[model samples]
Target: MDSDMSMHASYAFKHTCWGILLLFLAGGVADCSVVVTVSGPHVAKVGSNVTLNVFITGATRPTIVWAMGDIPVVTWTLGSSSPPDILDPGGVLSIERDGSLSFHNVLLNYSATYTIRVVELGVGSNTSTFTLRVFERPSGDPMCSVTGVNGNQDLQYRCQWAGGTPEAQLSFPVLNATSSGSGDFNLTRKPSQDLNGKEVTCVASHPFLQRNCSVTARGPADFQPLVSSMVDADKKLVITIACASTSLPVATVTWSKGNQILTSGGRYQISSNTTLLFILDFHLNSTELGTYTCNAVNILGNQTNDVSVLGPTVSDLGLFPNQEGTMVTLTWETPRTSVITGFEVQMMGPSLLPSPGGRQRRKRATNEFGTIQEKPSSARSTNISGLDPKATYRFRVIPTAGATRGQPSKELRAGPGGGLSGPAIAGIAAGIPCGILLILIIIALIILCVVWRRKRRQTRYPVSRAVEKVVATQPNLNTPHTLLTGGLKTSAGPPDYSVHLASERSSTLPSVVSPPPVRMATTV
Candidate 1:
């Protein structure tokens, strides 16, 4: 009985040992199933530092391997004393002891798929993928441009921003529109009259930064008007004026004189486009001469330009000076009318008196008439003498009817050295070159004349024989014989050169041609 009990205890101890060994093996197998968890898909901006961390489970003494697109980047055994092995030549990549990958100043070329493999010693290995993306921020604010389309009925706004990894997203807040990744954004809308002078804005968005730009909507700018007058075939004065303006939808132009608006009628003719105004058969005595206003109106704003029309005052005013430059003759013409009683000649020059400071300081010259002289209505010209030749002068003529003065003529300037006017100087300057050219022509004519005389002497006998033969073959006339003399063919006989001497003894013949009559207009 004692032997049986000892054997049974031994058997039970063996069974307990086997069961404990199986349980230990099973736990070891479970621990060997290594798993790697990582926060993947990393994102970073250029010139920034980033890290891709990994959380590893069921690993002991983990050996970490990091690769980027099939290329090994770094590897290290966790808890090792030595530094992590970095396979990158630039040394910009590193691995931490916790199996995390670090990038110092990431570059665009570093953006790719990265794989991290965590292997537990005497266990299985697992991998986690991390996608790295490098982005670039926009350099500046987006630019905006506006243009008219569809016959200027609609305005198109465009916004653009260039140079980024993924193009920036653009939006127009006014239109509630966004870009479709086409690199630029566009929005078009019909502009209403009330929408004039409105502001439009565009915005650009990116992961790294955001920007915007704006423009203004306007209308009716830069108004211009041109006025001109001329005389018609019927001797009637005609006035014409044209106006233009720049605007988005075009503008309407209107013409007015004083408080009365003008339209196409008996005398007034407006163009179909309403940009031109013409007054036909304009009479000086009529109430047509005044300030004419052209108003251009549009949805945005209005602009006005004024043009003045006046009756005939003075025309064709001329200034001539003597050779010594001390005296100047002023001549002018006017429509012979009873409205103008006489004319006033006004002159302006430097003050002859010295300043109180005892120094002749140059004073600003003014248009105020210093010397005024009146001439009768019949006098067309007058002589101004006893003038300093070295003083510069400016002259203008004002027409007066009893007490009221009409418009003044344009100012004429005469430089120093007597009354040498601008036209006189120009004439003198032109005459020099003309004189030289005339002399050269005269010399050429003389040389030609000499050569002609020699040639005539050589051919004189032959020419005489030929003429006699022709005269003998021609029919005889009842009148006196005629001869060609001085290269002239005359119906009557050759003119007697000696008759001029006899005429010199008698009174000089009178000029049959009379001066042309001047046409004058009636003035009010």
Candidate 2:
């Protein structure tokens, strides 16, 4: 036991002797009076680089040592015979010959008290320490929200900034309020009368980011609608009205007549949110010409408009028949027309034609035929078909304009088969002259044929008959050649004798020697 205790005491004595010798050596080297100081920024952002420089004066050759919170991290010496002069344990530190230490890609763990020591070859070491602060930049700008409180008399606004190392600051100008709450800030203010329609603003600020947001205050207003009325072509009364309002909150529009509420369906058409159209179709009467009202309501107040109705007017009226006489088309014209619903046609006809049946049946048929017909206003004309061909009928037209009917037109009559139509009469007129000319031509041809046949017989058989006749007249006058040579008859005298002989032969022959043939007849 004594021997072990003496061994431990000798080991402690040797360590103390070595420590004192090192201290004396350090004092002697520091007696050269070399001074070292460090200068640089104390704050740095994460992901940024920083340099802490150890500045030494009055030293020709110096060594640098870097430590973090009393833990040695690296050391550097100049012109050392050793293989490695720089001792960086974690490879996060580097040093320059000027005793400047640099940290790359600094992190939160790097935020600490850092000490830099500088030693001259024959002088003692000098040390300096500085606190390093590392912070992260804000990821985004501040967000702001505004809401109306206390019935819009006051407004509350908040600004928020998140995802940053340090808290953000918020401010409200309109509200004159500011408060911070864990990266969020809020403010509320009761506005004065002068602040009406003013803008509310909130601004936030941080070391790395700054942002602002704003909103405006507006109030509601009142408006009235404009209304008008007219009669449509379909004889329906149309009411048109529109209203508009400029308000923060939208206004509602409605249509009404007297105490009756009108909506968008059937006869009432809501053309737009602000416009309406009312059509009077079924209960069409003069009463439809009345005043209409439009109401536009908002938070501010309500307004109304009244428009009186403009009734329809009547114009030119006429009637005519269709091309086919079986159907009669009644036509009439409307001038300055507006919203004419339709036309109505009324007809009265003579009693029905006598039938093979009894008188009671005919009377019933006549009653049916006299019934009136009506057509829509769009159909400018009314066609009445299936009428008795020989029967006569009277037609009258009435124009309806917006629940009002115009004066009836004058009556017109028509008969389909009572007499020849215009076309038939015109054809007869044209054919009469041609028929007379044709009959005269036929008589003339017949006369020409008879005369020609007589001339043909005279030329073919009369010479022999003349000789035979002379022989019969004078027993020895046998031949026409003897008569010709004897100069008994000249050409004129012989033609006269031939005619006289022809007249004796047939009583139809004419005298005056027939004046020699004007045109000779050819035998075929």
Candidate 3:
């Protein structure tokens, strides 16, 4: 039995050796070979077309099959082509019996990692993996622009764009990333004045042959300097304009009449202190009248200010007391225009009130013509003869010359309707209250002095008065002590039996003969 078992083992071992050799030989040859794989993109967008390959060839063609996300695409075999058939239709995929796979109008849901396998009738199947990914194109309006950072410096923004089945390369102009595309960007740009308000654009590129996406940015318009002025009668007008603070941008300042531009040759005259953004002063003469517009401008913008210097502002208008009458003394020193010829001093009141509106041209006057006009010193004192002490009137000296004639000077006095006229208010109304206040002050001073003196005496000599009253009750100096004792007698009781007193003589009163006994009177 043991021998038989050994013999059986020997045969089994020999058979196994033969089987291994046969397997090795069979691997080298086959009836047919299968090769399955995906052509086209590994990651594809939805609604797309792709070719899936499943080739079976060695001997006779075998059946080939394909599937996407669990849905079968095709199942066929191309052998002698017994009968050809078209299985799946539009939006789906298909494959001929020959093992050629085609995907039609794909959807996002169709996207997946697909497995393609080919089988040679009796042989096993071979498969390959394919991954699909879907993405959309980008869209929007993008642009670039520039704004002022300082006087000479500007900032820029670049807008960029792109469209594709996936992220693609986006091109943008020289600009800050802040405006670059619709995605991640950073502000990075330095611009010059010439680049300010300039236009820029961006172009996007994608792999497929599609129209490129684009965007552009145009920026900050030109800025005009804001101009302003303060009119000064005794000095040149100080003109100030607002402008960019950095880079010291240059500016040209000018003067004009009304809205007409002024030139050095024209009647208009102007002077400036600064050629750039700054605070400056401009002088205007009496001749440069009407509407004085100070203009400031640069390459960026321009600004104008219209200052109405109507007339010669009168200073020091008064009446000098004179023996003949009141002398009208007036000074023409002020915001004088070259247009003023001189002045008219007219008197119209005193039952002869001429101009109630303070504008009576047909009144009496001492015509005064000015000399060395541009100089304030030339507008010194001018005397005019005028009478009427009890009458009240509004007085004014009008200026006329150059453009000064077109624009009248400000009113010197609006009359009593506006201000105090003549001596009526100055003498009766104002002076009376002042006089009353002075009298009351004097009376109060006298009363205060009396009260102060009385208080001082009480503080310095409080007991002296009481001692004098006691001394008055006694008579002679023969016994001054006795006399003092006599005053000690109480009105309600007899005198005390024992009493000691110290005698103190005042430096003012004599110690010799005394006066008769006299009681000091007291009252409540």
Q: Choose the strongest candidate by lDDT.
A: 1
The model with the greater TM-score, 1 or 2, is 1
- Between prediction 1 and prediction 3, the one with superior TM-score is 1
lDDT tens string, model 1, 188-216?
77777655767778878887778778876
Candidate 3 regions with alpha-carbon error over 4 angstroms = 1-32, 41-48, 59-61, 69-90, 108-111, 131-136, 139-164, 171-186, 194-203, 209-524
User: Candidate 3's residue-wise lDDT over 1-524, tens digit each?
Assistant: 99998876675455444433433343343332554545667555555776665444453565444555444444445564554232343547666555656667765555577655455545644656677665555455333333334553434343344444554444444443333333322243454455434444454444442333332222322343333444346443444333322221234566555656555432233445332222224434454335555555544455555555443444445544455344444454444322223455544344233334665544442333222123222354565443344434444555443223323233233222344535556677778888999999999999999999998876332344656876688567675464444554355666444432223332355459865555555433
**Candidates 2 and 3 compared by TM-score, better number:** 2
User: Model 1: runs farther than 4 Å from truth?
Assistant: 1-33, 81-83, 89-91, 150-153, 176-182, 221-524
Cα lDDT tens digits for candidate 2, 305-422: 6655434333554555556556666666654213455566776665434444646433322322233666664566666675566677766676665456767666666875445646
Best by TM-score: 1
Cand. 2 Cα-lDDT? 0.61
| Candidate order, TM-score descending | 1, 2, 3
Per-prediction TM-score, please? 0.38, 0.36, 0.30
